[model samples]
Target chain A: MAQELTTQAARDMAAANGDANRRAMAFTPAVDIFENDKATVILADMPGVAADDVDVTLERQVLTLRGKVTPDAPQGYRQLSAEYQVGDYIRVFTLSDDIDQAKIKAAFKNGVLRLELPRSPKAQPRKISVKSA
Target chain B: MLQTVFSPRNNGDLFADMRRMQSAMNQLFEGTRTAGQSATFPPVNFWASQDSIVMTTELPGLTEQDIELTVKDTMLQLRGTYPEPENGDDITWHRHERVDGTFLRTVELPFRVNPDHIDARFENGVLTVDMQRPEGDKPKRIAIKSA
Candidate 1:
């Protein structure tokens, strides 16, 4: 039941994510996240997204992912086979306060976006070795 | 077995010839050999930098948990699973474009990337892999001796 609920929530979020300016947009972005020693890395799959067209905004605790992809042809060309589309991508994620907002960073290359979210300074690794002074 | 590739048998060696034809057909009806857009394989681009090799691929419609990345030898591989659009069926697609399938794209690396240090991240619809070079391979500044 919970899984179903979450899926439904995502659907709702996607619907609420897009805007009118975009020629097209993706409601969802395929992504993968992992934790490292210093930061959490987030990878999103956005084909056809141009570098200048992407917008990454962090407001309060919500991270919004947005971008636009340029269409290949202006018009009037017969497309032989097209497995990709042109559109903008919009999505939002509620983040925890454990993230260092000021230190968050992002990069877009080859249709992929990488967001680096550093852990809070307090979360840094420290050794609590027993030193009987 | 290696020489058999050159042997004369209709197209080549009987088995080798058949395999070549099959691969060609797959590329035509489907695509060369790309991970299906429906499958886990996201499209990405990888290039070399002065100190590191970077890779990026597309993975729209997936959350963070839907991907898995692994490195072996000098090759990097990504795998993941994602649901097709809710309208996967409803669409009377005049032209279909998303590549979907159980897709795995293996990238061969020119230099070895420290597996322990490999960093994979996702945002928007792209996956970025930060491949750090082995310590010894990194450039170092030499001490300047007095001339």
Candidate 2:
């Protein structure tokens, strides 16, 4: 079945209010959300973000994902042309009542973050058997 | 009865109008999708010094074995694939926005590079390629003779 995907939020660059030390940009990573019978899964693409730099937190029904991308330019080279933008990634999502918040699991590999949010038992569909007298 | 008669639209009609508005909004944002499909994948950043040129690109979900890099004259070509994750038959997707498949990005540098002196490294999904400028292409600083 085709799933309806929605972009709840967008990538916003960090505000640089005349601060010389402020970083140039911050992007919201592209994400994919999917669901199965057991759980809903979210995949976020954050290239250049190492596993150690990623932080995922759930607080009061709100889930937040943040990843920092360290600049990896080779030593003593000055940037000449930059066709791609680079920066940290931040995004948040509100959890629904059907999600089992306590059982959420997350994994990061190859700069892709995978989150699994299991469904509550009550939310799962059950087959009912009718009795014939 | 008076309110119903004077109402601008019914609930069903209102919902249909909202659906229409949503689709129209989506159409407005369709340009973002096409913009990303242009000739670049794993978009790159380039740097130049007196003797060398450096380039870097982001390649998430890829490994060293999945990529091929080639440099000839002043042109550098990168080819790679980001394989999709395996899922069971019962899975249902709610959203899929990331680009997945084979991609090739070729960039032309301002000066020819030495093929034997090129260096490439992949770490944390980022690929950095460094190439030394050819001896003939390097800028020569001539010493001024005292008159």
DockQ per model, Cα = 0.06, 0.53
List candidate 2 stretches off by more than 4 Å: A1-21, A122-133, B1-36, B85-88, B135-137
Highest lDDT, which number? 2
TM-scores for every candidate against the unseen true structure:
0.42, 0.74
Q: What DockQ does model 2 achieve? A: 0.53
- Residue range A18-97, candidate 2, lDDT tens digits: 44675756676777887788888888888889899999988777787878888777788899988788878777787777
Summing lDDT over every window of 10 consecutive residues in candidate 1 chain B, give the lowest-scoring window.
B88-97
Tens digits of per-residue lDDT for model 2, B10-126:
564767667777888888877777654544676789988889988998887788999999999988888988787657888876667777888887889878999999999887778
Please provide, for model 1 over A29-110, each residue's C-alpha lDDT reduced to its tens digit, 9 standing for 90 to 100: 6556556656666666666577788889877777878766665332332333233444556766777667888888898865
Clashing pairs in 2: A34-B94
The per-residue C-alpha lDDT of model 2 at residue A65 equals 84
Q: What C-alpha lDDT do the candidate models reach, one value each?
A: 0.62, 0.78
- Estimate, for each residue in B92-125, the C-alpha lDDT of model 1 and write its tens digit: 2221234444566776776888888888776555
Q: Quote model 2's TM-score.
A: 0.74
